[model samples]
Target: MQRTFLQPDDVRDLVTDQFGGGRRPIALDRLTGGSKKGVYRLRLDDHSTAILYVWSAGENYWPPSLTVPDDPFTDASGAELFAVSHAALVAAGVGTPQVLALVRGSRYFDADVALVEDAGVDTLEAVMERDPGAAVGPLSALGDGLRRLHTTVGAEYGKLAAVARGEASQRRRVEDVIVDRALGQLRGAAAHDGRIAEAHDRIAGHVRHLRGAVAERRAYGLIHGELGPDHVLVSPAGEPLIIDIEGLAYFDVEWEHAWLQLRFGDAYPMLRPVDLDPHRLRLYRYAQVLSLIEGPLRIADTDFPERQWMLDLAERNIAKALAAV
Candidate 1:
């Protein structure tokens, strides 16, 4: 099927109708780095802006064959996921861009659309790059949000949308679920990359061994599964607001920290994280590299333009995953 993109007029009518204003959107520009859905900035005639999320098959760059339906970690897309995730975060007192309206069916087009308030600021990643000193406040804010978010625990462990709809399967162990998904990615990655293929046994064994080392836990902390600097926005008042939040769920706080440590690098100390399980962190860090290796290779095979970046990501992580063994 041919992939389609959205135009300003495609959303303007919906925007005006939902927002109930004479001021229509003057421009709807597509934002980059959105692989799973169409992310657009809807600039209004009044100089205000909102974000539009369109979940459609055409908008996604990921191959359907790559994702497993049973994997809790896979494909946290769609309007329901976004809405539930937004609500979950808000309930925890964690800041996310406020969702303005939702269009469930294709009232305007052949996709689920959500209009959300724009973060209206540079991403924490960009801010950290342009001026490291400027990043201190935002990082502090983000760290605070994470601390609060992790305090809110849940009985079940999985994506909020799935959990809300009773779609999450009852499992004996959360680490088991994590181990299963990581194994799938690494095995698939081994098929394509000679490095992972050669070290497949050792890498797979390493992951399984790490899983065995993890202890059974009772409490599950809420987490932004993909909490990278790029996923955070720093508002003008120095508050950090999380975006691309469809993957929000209750899980090990250590899992969130592992990603934060990898993405935040030297600045991770700003978060002042405490009392984490090292065993889980080690397991998650190494296993998530497998996901990094496979996900890029999968998407790179599609019509995604950033093929080289994807390959480079997979290539670099190949060494990381191999070294973990």
Candidate 2:
């Protein structure tokens, strides 16, 4: 069944309250690709625009049973998570949409709503495809921003929100947590795809081998758990502004480079990523591939517009993961 999304009328009062009656909402259209929250482009009568992020039970696709709210690697959604991640990114000098107004327990809807500046509609992926050199400046800026983000670490490794609240972490080492996530993702992928199921044992064995090869580390870097090119917006001024930042965590930077390698592909070199441990990168590559395979397959079950793309991504990563083993 299709659900009704918020319209201009639904948030007309909100726009009036925030931007005043002179800037009432003229149009409200939902943007594609945000599975955890409702991303809508709100246009005002004067033609100015803002992005609305709504966190409600109706918007989120993940079930409550599957979420580990405090875990660094679990379903990291909700208004609190977004606020915390946004604060962390802002403090680290990362580019993001400026927060306009934060409405909690809104009268329009029983949810949290955030009004933010519009960072343009074109993502880094589209900009990169428009021309080979289109993404170079943005990617270089992203490299500099990521350096500041990664170097901004904490005493305990976990979601930035938990760390902010002085929560104690159960995992002793980042490597151990990564290996556990890999094993979990391996099982999830095997259950979803027959080809992955066939080589499950072999892949599991290789994961165990890689686990042992990783050395102990005392520190980890902050990371945007999912940094796909699509998640990055290329502003008109040729800047890379990060979106969907609810997954900021203090973890191994190699986990980040592994994602950059997978998502950025041929364009990875433009970012000029630095100081990644080869051993962590190797293990993280397998873990990242398994995660990529499992994630797309899982999200494909939702009412996402790019359903076929998700399945294709899963298939490609499955091939990559199987070959690596």
Highest lDDT: which candidate? 1
lDDT of 1 by residue, 52-85 (tens): 8999888888886555545566778888888888
TM-score of every candidate:
0.95, 0.94
Q: Indicate the residue-level lDDT of 304 in model 1.
A: 94
User: How many residue pairs clash in all the candidates, one count each?
Assistant: 0, 0
Task: Predict model 1's lDDT versus the native.
Answer: 0.85
Tens digits of per-residue lDDT, candidate 2, 257-278, equal: 8888888999898777878789
RMSD of 1: 1.6
In model 1, pairs of residues that clash are: none
For model 1, what is the alpha-carbon lDDT of residue 168?
68
